[model samples]
Target chain A: MALSAFILIEVAGDHTKSAFKTIQRISGVKAVYTVSGSYDLIVQVETENLQTLSDLLLSKIRAVDGVTKTNTCLVLNV
Target chain B: MALSAFILIEVAGDHTKSAFKTIQRISGVKAVYTVSGSYDLIVQVETENLQTLSDLLLSKIRAVDGVTKTNTCLVLNV
Candidate 1:
């Protein structure tokens, strides 16, 4: 089964397309999209387990060049 | 001065209207709105400090009926 998570990220620069591309390449990431108002980007990621999800975010998503901050919400159910 | 926070809340029932009213009544809550996809409700709260904001959510907002889960996003700037 895949664990779903919604990641709300803040980027320092206007590299929306690049950020989306980078997040797509990360393991376990399912989808990414731009949101209006408050948050810059919303990413949907799926993983086999929570630990793997966290690891992928720490090592990959957070390490992306323009990403300034990230807040993750683990989806408990549909 | 004020600190802004975006709160993502999950409701067990279809009580979107009631949730918005209850959250708006909270001391530090600035605005509340419904968003599409993933999370059910998004609330914007402004407080004098982070601790006050946390307190408001824990004491008042979270205690409201119908709210199943809540995740807070603190806005650092803009």
Candidate 2:
């Protein structure tokens, strides 16, 4: 089954535009949008399973420059 | 321009399944999913502008039965 999450991102500097460009290219990221709120970006990501989701967050998302903190909310099937 | 948001919903009872069904049918709602976390559901909605988005949240989403609280994160353009 596919696993999806909304990864709320906080960027360190005034690099929202450049950061968004780089983030949109990540493999598992479906979409990324800058938002007018506490969070700088709203990222939609989907992976095959939880493990892949975890990897995507750690290896890809976190590694990106300008990203400071992340709050991941996993989508559950009910 | 299209305005989109991720509305985090909290349900009052064991009505997640029913809530999801009702929420999905609302106009402007792109998707609704039961999610694992503080929020019971992740509702994706898109409207023509911020006013329409506000109307959707008040007249449509908040009106749904079993939904207690909502935290809306407006999607911003970068």
| Candidate whose TM-score is highest | 2
What is candidate 2's lDDT per residue for A1-78, written digit by digit as tens?
898898888898897788899999999999898886677888989999889998999999998889999988888767
lDDT of each: 0.75, 0.87
lDDT of 1 by residue, A42-74 (tens): 676888886888788898899987899887766
lDDT of 1 at A32: 71
The interface root-mean-square deviation of each model, in the order shown, is 9.2, 1.6
The pairs that clash in candidate 1 are none
- The clash number for model 2 is 2
- Off by more than 4 A, model 2: none
Scanning candidate 1 chain B in windows of ten residues, the lowest lDDT window is B31-40
TM-score of 2: 0.87
